[model samples]
Target: MSKLFLLVFIALSQRVQSFGIGSTLYCYQCVSTQPGCSPFNWFWHWSQACPEDGDTCVKVIERKGASEVVTRDCLSALKGVRTDIPADHYEGCKPAAVDVKLGNYVFSSIKELDVKKDYYDETTFCFCSFDNRCNGSSSLKVNKSVMFSLTALFMVIHFLILR
Candidate 1:
């Protein structure tokens, strides 16, 4: 009936509305390597570190031709590495170590400390309704109930009119 159609339309119009807000946090951890070393040269290359924590150190080596072997120190060379907490609640990157130097050539007679860097990133999302009246939890509940009632009333009216 016309009344039924009207009720259905009203009910459909009163739907649960939602919106979202998001934020992200980033952190970097640096692992120091010999000068001119590239983290990408290695299999896994990512950069990540704990913002609050200092930096992390990682050792790396480089291969030249087929026989030449090089050793070097890499600092926070990885990219998109994650060192954040509460893994499930948020998303972040994880860093890995990479050997950048190739061929055994000792710059100094003494062995230098090898180090790499790590980083962390975070993202968040908040969802809410568009209606100003549905700003808070209680408001949202009230709005939902009101919407349902209006839809039901409209449907009843439509049904009676059609009949």
Candidate 2:
């Protein structure tokens, strides 16, 4: 449908603009407690540049009682908390057992963080590197090559449908 195409187009366009030439990488900084943070809508509005020291973007989601809390920001923003990661990491969210509630935040970009020890029902963290606004909705982040391939495939499908 045209709707799907439009969505894809918009996403790709935003990605290109965000990750384009820039000194600091951009990320979607928000808290689920606030509007547009929950059910995270990854759009230009949420994109924010990370600090110069910020090398990664993070997203953490915590499920408490009847609601979920989400947090998204630069890895460096974790002031007092420490996030550990293996030398080898990739872009994507890996679910870890929750020791406590994490507000939707980033990782593999990290291995662990003792940010808070208050046990929660569930929590998930996602981390990504180098890309602007890389920490957005959909824990499964897409790479440039894949996005291009998808765009090409969709264009073909659209042309075929036109005929």
Candidate 3:
């Protein structure tokens, strides 16, 4: 009987080990109209662990005029959303139109551009990363060479003007 119990215990332990711990992702919880937390404001106190079914961290942004409404949450792999179509339909991404006007000189527009286009639906920004605490902050990529050249050009112009 003791040997049988030991075998059963070992089997259960192995099953638990396979599942493992730290399977949850971290997300932020805040609102755009909540007093001190306004317009993409986030606090450490609002961070939370994702649900058992969630495997990725997500940040959703919707732009309204000059302010943006942001929501950080956890996401599952198979989730879908509807946009510019009927219900029960899912398009991973959609094309959008953008208009730009610079003073009275240039007025230009772009039509049908492929944006992030994910299951998050029609949003200004929808980002997803597969890791714990990945959604804690906004991610940006900058080219070091471009930045360095711009800086050097500005310094050269400044020196010429001062001389």
Worst 10 residues of 3 by lDDT: 82-91
Better of 2 and 3 by TM-score: 2
Model 1, 1-163: lDDT tens digits are: 5656666675556434322112211221222242222332322322232232222223222232443222221123322432221222222222222334422363543333322211112222111222222211232244566666877786676567556
lDDT (0 to 1) per candidate: 0.31, 0.65, 0.45
The C-alpha RMSD of each candidate to the native structure, in angstroms, is 18.3, 10.6, 20.6
**Candidate 3 ranges beyond 4 A from true positions:** 1-21, 35-44, 76-122, 138-163
Query: Which TM-score value belongs to model 3?
Result: 0.38
Clashes of each: 49, 19, 0
Candidate 2, 65: how far from true, in Å?
Answer: 4.1
Tens digit of per-residue lDDT, candidate 3, span 43-162? 433656666564555554655456665555555422453132222212122222222331235333432332323223345434444444445443322344655575567556555754
Query: Once superposed on the true structure, which residue ranges of model 1 sit more than 4 Å away at CA?
Result: 1-85, 90-142
Candidate 2 scores a C-alpha RMSD against the true structure in Å of 10.6
Candidate order by TM-score, decreasing, is 2, 3, 1
Better of 1 and 2 by lDDT: 2
- Where is model 1 poorest over a 10-residue stretch in terms of lDDT? 117-126
